[model samples]
Target chain A: MNFPPPITRLIQHFRGLPGVGPRTATRFVFALLNKSEDELRAFGHTLVDFKHSIRTCKECFNISLQDPCEICSNQKRERTLLCIVARPQDIQAIEETREYNGLYHVLGGVLNPIDGVTPEQLRIKELLTRLEGEQKFQEIILALNLDIEGEATALYLAKLLKSRVPKVTRLARGLPQGADLEYADEVTLINALKGRRDI
Target chain B: MNFPPPITRLIQHFRGLPGVGPRTATRFVFALLNKSEDELRAFGHTLVDFKHSIRTCKECFNISLQDPCEICSNQKRERTLLCIVARPQDIQAIEETREYNGLYHVLGGVLNPIDGVTPEQLRIKELLTRLEGEQKFQEIILALNLDIEGEATALYLAKLLKSRVPKVTRLARGLPQGADLEYADEVTLINALKGRRDI
Candidate 1:
């Protein structure tokens, strides 16, 4: 029942995650124990490297190696349209469509009252500051999930952007309620984007 | 969309696991990235330590910090009873029950001919060696899963052990069919153990 101190500690650490339980943590740690020293080293080094290398983009708050982020800095991308997403993974979902040529504003999280995640907890203030008059975005699309918190955040953003932007839109319905934007199929996401209605 | 070289390599490594997909790999890497530097170092060090610290017990084939394993070396354990399991995790499961005071023999893996895991590939030879009568066992319990591979391994071991030992038993049918032993609830597992039937 007694694992080596390090292995026990590793399982405890893995257990700290949102969905990982002690049993799953044991499975994960044992899998690591079965791996070769080189494999373990690679796994360990990757942990450090991921933390050291990936940083939140200064402009959009999306995870990136670069400061401005590739999406924010790309000249070929549409500058007059901005898609507001909740997380970095959400940005990847949008990009996979190959349809949304616009830049992104990653809020880092949705507004969840139970979690004490308010407007200030997200990158909302940073997002407002980044919206430039010279850049002149004609549309600000809220491509957040269809969940309650996602809806609340999108509604807040839509109302706030309505006064400043020419058009404020949210992705069309039928995206499988309470699910993640990441879980949406590419075609469904693309269709949702194409059929986005003004709020 | 673009991660650094080390982060990319780490995600690829995570993707190499049995059930992990590319998106899950990305999420896992990012989750690691969220860990503090000290935590990251701990995570990395744990992987290396778990692999380096654990060794396969020469007698039982169970992974442990010692050669004979804590269970094998313990004097108070029921030496006349040995539990045959498919993996080290199975040993951990039984140990957690705190009901079984018997020694254990890990087969390392079950016999799965389709996946090329033959009887010879398992620790059947070591198991046979342990039955040589100097420290004779009254009973050998086959605690392997009730799945096809597990059943095959148990039946093979049962045939071999029945010829050599006075009694050969199996964990009861209380366990749900096809589910992993590690996932069995503690009460159900305890019942299964207590209700063990002879083959």
Candidate 2:
């Protein structure tokens, strides 16, 4: 049987979300129906206010309430260091470590020429401006994906920034800390062997 | 790093959904934030209007647009036959088969004494009233779970409705449609052996 217009609409909305399919959407809608009127209204309010309440950092392009973002506004962070990443979520991944006190620049995405995502489409210009400006950045960390597109982008950026900046480094490649040697992929094993360091 | 207030609230709302936790909720919130302004607004509107649009069926207790529900209102459905289910979704499971043309009676849930779900708390009064009232039901199918609670509920209902109703039947226990003999549980294998019929 056909569901009512509102429920069908809600299901469609849920289906539009990443990783949610037809059955999952239906389940989510049913679960929502189980909530009290106040709870439903509260959730609805959150959805409605989400965009207006969250702002992209003008400096880092990280999603936050402030344009400069929490990281960019912090005074104690290293001034002469910058970490470039593909998305805002990657910043969270790095932030959770609490190791890197450097600022960030979200590229929006890696260079995917086939998908029409070029250097102009990314925050490459912004990255250059940040480097050229009064911040006097001494080091840049290109923490990006290992895919063909990511490598190509890294190469392109490295070539451009080599003359502009003193040092440009990529994250290390090796087997994960707890991973077994037998289960390691060929590329990872090769990289791990090639990049061996003194214990 | 802490998320914006709106984003954190949205994540909490997502976490309230079944099987969803902190990481999944955060992922869902990020995904929602990625949606366009119009799409997000439409989704919010759907959520806001959801409860107001869907009404519970007075006859069957199935959540629907109309009080009588689509099935209860349908002229083609068998008026004399009633399939009793533990929940409204169970009716959907049966309906997906496209076999049964009978009406349904959603019990909300089976009796679980430990959870304080007694006969008075359930739709048992409504079920009896339906059976005793103007609509003459020929059969009452106890399509409940096979758990101890469900079994106890079925037993209680069976004893009460045996003399009043013409027939009270339970779903047969056997191997599921696509199950292999080697992997089938002992109870199912035994039930399959016991309930074997002539070819």
Compute the TM-score of each model's chain A versus the native chain A and list the values: 0.84, 0.95
lDDT of 2 by residue, B1-199 (tens): 8788888889999889888888888888888877888888878877887889788999999888888899999999999998889887788888988988899998888898889999998899988888889989899888899889888989999999999899999889999999999999999899999999899
Cα lDDT for residue B174, model 2?
A: 94
Error of 2 at A123 (Å): 1.5
Comparing chain B with the reference, what is the TM-score for each candidate? 0.84, 0.94
For each candidate in turn, give its C-alpha RMSD to the true structure in angstroms. Answer: 6.0, 2.7
Could you tell me how far off, in angstroms, the CA of residue A199 lies in candidate 2 after the best superposition? Answer: 3.7
lDDT (C-alpha) at residue B197 in model 2: 88
Docking class of 1: medium
Tell me the TM-score for chain B of model 1.
0.84
- Tell me the TM-score of model 1: 0.86
**Prediction 2 global C-alpha lDDT:** 0.88
After superposition on all CA atoms, how large is the RMSD of candidate 2? 2.7
Which candidate gets the maximum TM-score versus the true structure? Answer: 2
**Which runs of model 1 end up more than 4 angstroms from their true locations?**
A175-199, B175-199
Task: Return the TM-score for each candidate structure.
Answer: 0.86, 0.89
Per-residue lDDT of candidate 1, residues B1-199 (tens digit)? 5565777798888766546688877787767666789887877776666666677889888887788888788899989998999888898788888999989988888999999999898888888888884899999999998778998888888888888999999976677778678999887788778878789
